[model samples]
Target: MPDLSTTYMGLRLKNPLIAGSSGLTGTRAGLLELQEGGVAAVVLKSIFEEEIAAEYDDALSEAARKGMSLESYDYYDYELRGAHVSQYVDFIREAKTAVSIPVIASVNCTYSHEWASFAKDIEAAGADGLELNMFFLPSDITRSSDEREKVYLQIVDRVLKQVRIPVALKISSSFSTLAQMIDRLSKTGIAALVLFNRFYSIDFDIEKMTVTGAGSLSSPAELAGPLRWVALMSRRVGCDLAASTGVHDGAGLIKMLLAGAKAVQASSAFYRNGAGSAGVMLKELSAWMDRHGFKAIADFRGNLSQAESVDPGVYERVQYMKHYAG
Candidate 1:
């Protein structure tokens, strides 16, 4: 059998398949299922910064309705942050105890604030690593691109300062200069970078005349974007690259590795096929590796990336050719 083990974000994975954060990985039972199904690591479902703030605001409104004093708002805010952090800390501790595979705590934060310090609590709770799901929609026309990019950098810097464990960033590809942004972020001392987060899109409900969700889950075709960027940036960036979004099967997993992703994170596949999807993908990868006469992941990984490919321009090509379009 080919050795599938690889290192991601400075942590050794039994294999390169990671169960990405989702409802499937939010609970102790879910973590065990992923481990039993053969995932090398698990990124716990992210604790959202907005969710905490929303909860705090709701609680304050309730307190006000009950005639709470004005001075109590500060206490309420502090306790609210603590309440969510305490629960997440316990979740991390329990997950660490239940499973031996690396438990990577995830935080979905829009800005670098008091919540960045919460990473320290997660680390102290025995999380092996942290993955920051950092992104903000660049819809504000008044904000310059540079100003928006600084938010991501500041959050990363603050979080890294608070935790000793490896930190990886899961980011969106929505940037004016994505390559430059990736280069700058990679130099900020992160252990790994997950290319492209799949965000919830808005869809119009024609019949109801209201907005609804648009394609909540990713299709295999979605892999092309990240695959291209990973192949282009894997060698150029200062940190390891992990591919996220649009990976649904073993072939997709293998392609990500070939494109130079040190690891591949799968969420929708697990949701569609259950935890066994990880095992299925690994089996397929191993069989492919054996057929190719490769003994380990590193032996063939990045073999097709832009840096190593003979036809490197294929990755750089953007415009659809008339010959192909026709």
Candidate 2:
């Protein structure tokens, strides 16, 4: 049997498969089930910045409708903010006590603000690390790309100052100079970078004439995007890389490792198969390693990365002119 243990973001994982943030990791029962299913770590469901902002807005709107005095409105805002922070702290504490595996707290935000102070409470609640799922939709026609990219750095700087634990940033692949952007983020004292966060897609309901979400889960075929970048940037970035989005099985997990990812996060695979899918993937990983005559994860990890490949240009090719025109 080959050794499956690997370290990610300074946390020692028994295996590389971490149960990524989702509803499945939102409670004690979910955490316990994932642990039993052999996941190395769990990133709790993200506390959304928009959700907190929305709650405050709704509270103020309701108070105004009731003709509440200004004093009462101020009190309601304070109370609502406290309630949200308290609930998240309690959840983190409970999860830490319930499982032996590392529990990483996650915050999904687009900008840096006072809400980042909550990271202090999360560290105090005993989270092993923090994963910031940050993306600024560059939808504003007036906002330059430089202005949009600065938000991520600003948020990370503020959050890192607030917490003592290791921090990782989960990002999307939408930047114009993706490699430069990622390298800049890696230099920000972060412990790891999770490649390619999955974003919600808008689909038109032709008959209803309304918009709906595209499928909420990633498909197996979705692995290619992260795979390419991980292989390309793994040798270039300043920090450890963890592959996210579209990793569905042991094969997907193996591909990520060979492509130079230190770890791989899976959510949709468990949704489609079950939490036990984690153990199944690990089993397959171990078997493959044995057949390849590898004794540990480090033995073959990054063996196929772009840095190590003779034909590295294959990873840089984006046009299909060669294949299609032929």
lDDT of 2 by residue, 1-326 (tens): 88999999999998999999999999899999999999999999999878878888899999999998999977976788678888998999999999999999999985577778889988999999999999888788998899889988999999988988999999999998999999999999999999989988999999999999899999989999999999998878889999999999999999999999999999999889999989999999999998999999999889889999999898888887878458
Estimate, for each residue in 113-164, the C-alpha lDDT of model 1 and write its tens digit. 7888898899999999999998899999999999999999999999888989
RMSD of each: 1.4, 1.6
How well does model 2 score by local distance difference test?
0.92
Per-prediction TM-score, please?
0.97, 0.96
| Top of the candidates by TM-score | 1
**Candidate 2 regions with alpha-carbon error over 4 angstroms:** 65-74, 323-326
In model 2, the clashing pairs are none
Which ten contiguous residues of candidate 1 have the minimum total lDDT? 317-326
Model 1, residue 181: distance off in Å is 0.4
Q: Report the Cα lDDT for candidate 1.
A: 0.93
- List, in order, the clash count of every candidate structure: 0, 0
